[model samples]
Target: MKELAHLNKYFFKYKFYLFWGIVFTLISNLFGIVPAQVVRHALEMVKANIALYFLFENSSLQVSSYKIITFSIAVFGVLILAMAILKGIFLFAVRQTLIVMSRHIEYDLKNEIYAHYQTLPLSFYKKNSTGDLMARISEDVSKVRMYIGPSLMYLINMVILVFLVLSYMFSVNARLTWFVLIPMPILSLSIFLVSSIINKKSEKIQKSLSNLSTFVQEAFSGIRIIKSFAKEEKFVETFTKESENYRKESLSLTKVDALFSPAISFLIGLSTVICVYVGGQEIIAGKITAGNITEFIMYVFMLTWPLTALGWTSGQIQRAAASQKRINEFLKIRTDIISSENKNQDLQGKISFQNVSFTYPDTGIKALKNISFDIKEGESIAIIGSTGSGKSTIANLLFRMYDADEGKILFDDTDIKALNISNFRNQLAYVPQDVFLFSETIRNNIKFGINGVADSEIYESAKKAEIYNNIMDFEEGFDTKIGERGITLSGGQKQRISIARAIIRNPKILVLDDCLSAVDTNTENAILNNLREIMKDKTTFLISHRVSNARLADKIIVLDDGKIVEQGTHEELLATAGMYRDLYEKQSYSETVPS
Candidate 1:
């Protein structure tokens, strides 16, 4: 209910459009009831004609009676055409207003969700499935639109139309109105039961659809791995299973949804049969005129459609309500990275940690335990360890991707939590182990986030990363479009482009997470040399396992099982004859024995 109510803000903004829409609906209905009134008048006129003919069988003026009836019908026909036209015009206005309201809600919800997504820490994405997130943004939002534009409007119309139509009938004949409304309770009870079933089935259907999306996304993303292992048949079998499940659930939901309208309508139809039976008897018994019967029956039948709408509108509300619940769950996730209210402050390269500790939200064990370190401006450092030894965790902390569970990280002794996260991260540039490039030109990828950088700056950054020559060799040069994640480029080439992007930012701090593992030793050496020339003033944290990569850093640190075991210069560490020296010997020994 809270999530659905969030849309009320948008409705308030566009209330004037809604007001006019309702005004026109009233106008349309006013004209609509005109036909029902004319129907009653027609019955009166026909009865009068019958009496005149029966009583004055030989009257010469009977020709005038025929003329009077014909003229009355022609006038009714013109009035009906006019009513229909006005009704159509008002219907269009109502539909357009609903569309505008739906679109406004979509815009506001999309922006809110997207903005929330941006604020979430990296751990959130790691925990949540990408397929589920995409479903929220697309499928969930569309459900909200269905609720706002049609379901909600239908509800409003249902209330107004029922009240007004019932009031009119009651005024005409209280006894007859009581007979017509006999099925009203049965109709309400039926709709209530169906609506409960619809909510449960709709929730199941959405969950099934979410799984289907997950299967499709994962299957395509890992298609290469599946093919390499010859698992096409397995994937096909899996897809069939998921698709069949989705199909069954969707069919069940449709069946449940489809049963509602007819059930409501059946009860309403029962009332119609009674009206016809009772009304006919009354007229034949001379208790009421035929014109009165005609008016009452027309109004009684009019209640059927609105009653029927109540069922489907309930289902739509349930689906949208489920979607709204999902959306609110997403919005309610607290941003792990705390940001400052003032966001315009600049950052320098100096960073320090004091008695810092962190454990993932759901885990008892810590990723980084009681770790404390500091790096001055223009200092170069390397962090090396086995996989999952918390080497990258240090990089995560430096950028405040995840705040430390205990103590504080600081920028030159100022608490990192006190500074604006966006401004703080803007000061640092990181190139991760997995390189992600947009499906765009090499130049554009390098120039992302900032605009109007000169060609020379792009060339310089590419040259520093040792990718300039390869980019120039392409037929389209730097302008060539790189496929998604730079699929067109080799692994080594992709790493270099990622490097170029970081270097181009010319940030205060540079962090690389095993960025050069793909490139050959010769290219690695050249790239390192270029980085030395370009990164003189920039503070750097280099994460790697290879001794050659770590040797370039001014200071070296070794982590083992989330604890810092040793820290010193390369020569100092080698002289100490600790883990770094032993690891170096093992790597060097392997090089000589390799094929």
Candidate 2:
């Protein structure tokens, strides 16, 4: 009942169409029973007075029995035809309306689900699988749509059909009707027991399908890696296992579903057999007319279908309920980007960190801790650290991917927690170490986040990043499709395009998070030179392992294990003989020398 009420609200928009469709279906069913009743009445009338009317001596006959029989035949024929036509029309109307409504439900679910994705934190993506989310929006949502459309109509039809047939059956023969009700209780019990098992099995199958989807998604995403390592057979073996599991689960479901209707039909047939045996005995004793028995049989046959369908509808209800539970669970996850009735301050990017600490939620290892720092507006600061020395964690904190537990991240000495996070992040842009590009044209990728950038501004930013000339050399230039993950671009080209994306944003706080790692030494130097002068008045945090990049900053902070251990300019840091200087010597000694 709760599920039905929930479904009613969910499908309320299409209820009017469904209501009219059901009305037409009911009318058709009402007329559809006329022929059997007419047959019983005609038989009884013909028996008593056929000879009197035929002899032409019964002047008292208001209407001839022959005329009555002929008229009944014509009326029955037209009524049967009208029933068929109305049934077809109602079926068509229901189908059309449900199709349209299903599309609307699917469209809204996909869009809203994805919109939820956009608001969820980075940790949410880390914890969940993209393929699972895709399957929910595509396959699971489709299951819900099926329930709203055909399954729902079938359910309603069964109810109306049962009510009509049962009412007629009870009116004609109360004892036989009571006997029929016996099988109904058994049928309901069977449905209840089997449906619980079916629901559990179906949910397991859906989860297994989600796992298979995850496997396929991962395989495609890492195709190049798999091929390079010659692990095609391993992946194929894994996929085969998942596919076999899926097939077995689906076949198990087929077994459950296939048994339902046949079992229902058997029980219903048993009831009818009992009814005929009892009613036949009564008719022989002259307890009821032949017409009542005839009409009763017709009603019994009609009632069988609705009883049988109860078993089928049980299966559908379980499947739909399982699907609804999955969707509801997804919707329950709270988004990390908070939007509440409470207000927050606007930001001006005078960033300060006080005793900040962060640990990955799953791993429980501190990625950053006691990381105290301050950056005045327009100050060019550099973070020099080894690979795992929490350089990127700084950038992540600034972006508010994971909020700190022990400290305050402030902008203009105001806690960022009190600010609108989206509005706060809008003033900053990051050029990450590993660049990610969409499968789109180079121009679109450059102008991605900032869509309002002019063509000239795009070209200027591209030139500054040292990739403009290379782009122009291509046949289609910036308009050429970058292929999957910008595969068409060389590593250095991809990096430079990423830099151009950051540059075009013209952010108040620009983070160069090892942005030069992919580029050649010459290209890196040129791009940094241009960027340093252009962003002189904008606060910049340069993060890198190489001394050359850090040497350009006004102040350099060297870190080890989430805490800064040294702070100085390039010469001062080298003179100090700290971890940064040692790392610099190792990297510097490996540089090229002209032969």
Candidate 3:
């Protein structure tokens, strides 16, 4: 219940619905109690007529007695039927308000979680799995809905019905009322003992289900790799283990749920037996009539469903509390990156890394050590480094995917952190080393970021990436749908399509991080030739290992062991005989010697 306290705001948000629902529940229960009283009067009327018939035997009064009894019984029957009909009408109204309100809350809650997910930093995703996130928003939310909807509705109806029936019984005879209620405290004690066990088990069950969901998601995503390695049987064995664990947890909960109905029915049956025995004793003592005994019995039976629902509703609330606790965990996570309120700055792409230093938070490895560089607007600089030399870290800092720990990064001589994050990112386009494309058509993939883009722009961008002829060869061409993460396309095609996507943005600054690695040398040269023309007036950072690419840049910076070992024009670096000249000589020798 403490965990479920988070939903108080939603309850207040739809207070009108809650108000109407309670009103309907009260009216319906009131009408529901009327039928028992109607039955009592009808039975009493028949019993009195029987005595009158015996008294007026063999006389003309007997015929009149029969006529009166028949007409009165018929009226009582109609009255009971009317009460039942009214009760049903209000019950429908109860569902319309309370049940409908739960659905609205569910919608708002899911949207709120998804919107929060969009604001969190990349490091948060590294800490959580995709399936766990999906489970929280989908499965956990559904359990909470059950508590808000059917469980809540039944709880209100049960409470109202019990109150109305008990009040009427006490008004008629307090002694019989007390006897009928003997089993209630015992039933409550049973629920109290069982509810604690239910809360603990329900938490374990939700966690196991989350684990199962994560396993299935990863297995399906990597099915191709499994099949290629001929490890299908291994995967099947692991899946079976996860599935069996889930089934065992579920069975434990089901065993507890199975106890609720029988225990409730037995307790309610005991109440009925007590009512009959006590009412008989009272009738024999001439303290109450047979019809009064009948009325008391009906009242006991009227409380049967509500008592039964008590145990079930208790279990539901415990389960809901467990689930809501899971949801609150993610909702409580605060992102480190907060966007600036000022979004009016326009960037001219003059970038500077002023003695910047950074360390990877997850790995605790220093990726950059007092690195400093500058690039004026309209200049192309290539960052040349071997693997693990921190080439991509520069690009990440420029995009503000992360902030530098030690020094300032400036754009147009202003601190990048002070600028509006969204507005600052709008002027930059980045093509990562590992390309990712959506399961969409080529044209839509190319035009993903910017809206209202013309078809000609898509065609021109594809041509600049040197994938235009290959697309034309396909049957659907630009309309062709690429499968998940562009798996349907070859590696080179996927890379080129990503390049086309970045090109269509026409950003003021472009960072191509080894994006042309897959294509052949000829296609790479052709794309680079097109990029040189496009980058004539725009700032570009070409991050690559190949000397061929670096030799064409206006400036080249060579990195080694998390520090810049050299920085100059290709000709000047060659004159210095530093790391850059050594890399160029090795690459040149390898190319000249045949493979």
Candidate 4:
């Protein structure tokens, strides 16, 4: 009930339409009662005329009096036809108003969910899969829409119908109404029991579906790796197993859902049998007219549809509750990263790690331990380390992707935690090792970091990153659409384009995390030369294992086992005859002796 109440805010947002929709539904239901009453009155009139004919069987005048019956029938016929037309009109209004409102509400809710996703921190995404989030947004949200729209509309109509029909039934024969209603309590109990089971089963079914979606998404995303490894059969078997589980869970829910309608129908059938038996005895006892019993039977049949629909509506409500719970689980989680209430302050190029130590969530090992370094404005520093030596972790901290587990990081001699996250990040640009490009034109990818950039700026940035010539070689040049993840371009081209994207912003601080590893040595040297010119007025952190690249920085830092072991100029490190010098010699030997 609490979940349902929370959902009503969406319905109430379009109260104008909902108000008119309810009014129209009430009018339509009122029209429905008229036709049944007209039929009863017409039957009563016929019974009386037949009796009069029998009393005066020999008189022609008596037979002439029956002509008035023809006019009476015609009047009732016209009333029924008019009522049917009015009912149709009101029904159309109800659908247009209420049903259309649901569609609008669905649009708003989808946007809200997506907007919330954009605000979530990287750690949230790390713990959740794309498929599970997609299922919640698309599949689960759609189920909630069903509950708000057709199910609620029909449920409200049923309530109105039962009330009006029951009132008339009691007016005609109170005793008979009591007998026919014997099954109502039992029907309600059955629906309540079955609906709870359906709710639980629906949750399991949604979860299984999310798992299946995740598997398919991962398979498609990693198709290249799977095909290269020749694991097609293995993947196919795994997908088949997941598909079977989804089917099994769905069928289990269906089994319980199918019981609702028939169980309600069986109870309704019993009410009909009792109505006919008791009402007939009343007629014979002269306690009621034949028309009264006839009307009572008709009302019982009129009650049949809403009673059965009640069962289905109950299941819909329960399924929506389960879906809401699933969606709220993610929506309710507060991100680990949030901005301080302090006023927005622009970051300068100066950066400092004051005894910073950090560990990733759910992992016991520290990625960075007591790391203290100062990077001055407009200076270039190279962070050299082997894999898992916390090189990227340093870049991540500068980018504010994660805060230090202990100690503080400063921007321009002020604690970075005091600045708004958006304003803090606005001063920096990053080119990560794993470059990702959208399936868009080359021009769009280059300009993705900033809004309202000019074509000349884009071209100049591409030229500086040494990718302009390669881009121009294509028939459409910058206008050509790159396939997913820039698959149409070579690794070297993708990395250079990514570089161009970063440089286009002309940030105060730049962090390049081994982004040049994919390019050839000659291209790497050319790009590095261009980068030095661009780095003249900006603070830069160059993360790489290539000594040739590190040699260009003013200062070099060597990391081993999450600790800084060496820090000096490139020449000073070599003079120490330490880890930096040994790594440089080994890399030089590998390059000279390579296949």
Give stretches of model 2 more than 4 Å off. 1-9, 12-28, 31-71, 285-294, 336-347, 593-595
Q: lDDT per prediction? A: 0.83, 0.79, 0.90, 0.88
TM values, all candidates: 0.96, 0.90, 0.95, 0.96
lDDT of 2 by residue, 1-595 (tens): 3443445654676666666767766765666566667767766776665675666655646356567756766776676677667767766765666556667766776777778777878888888898888878777777777676666666777788778877877787777678767777888888888988889887988898999999999998888889999999999999999999999998999888887888888887887787778788778887777777777777777776666667666777777777767766777788655634333554455788899888878677787878888888888789988888889988888888878768888778877666677777777888888789999899999988775779999999999999999999999999988877877778899989999998888888898899888888889889878987767778889999888898788788888888889887778888987887898888888785444
Off by over 4 Å in 3: 54-64, 285-287
lDDT for each residue of candidate 1 in 133-152, tens digit (9 for 90 to 100): 88898898899888988887
Cα RMSD to the true fold for all candidates: 1.9, 3.4, 2.0, 1.9
- Least accurate 10 contiguous residues by lDDT in model 2: 339-348
Best by lDDT: 3
Best of the two (3, 4) by TM-score: 4
Compared with the true structure, what per-residue lDDT tens digits does model 4 show for residues 1-595?
A: 5665656777778999889988998899999887888988998998878787667777986677577677788999999999999999999999999889888888887888898898887778878999999999999889888888888899889988888888888887789899999999988888888988999898998999999999999998788889999999999999999999999998998899889778877887898889889989988888887777777777777778887778778888888888888888887887767767654776667888889899888566799989998889888999999999999989888877888999899888888777788877877889998899999999999999588999999999999889999999999999999988897899889999999999998999999999999999889989999998999889999999888889879899999889999999998999998999999999999889958
Ranking 2 against 4 by TM-score, winner: 4
Question: How far off is model 3, as Cα RMSD?
Answer: 2.0
Q: List the residue pairs that clash in candidate 2.
A: none
TM-score of 1: 0.96
TM-score, cand. 2: 0.90
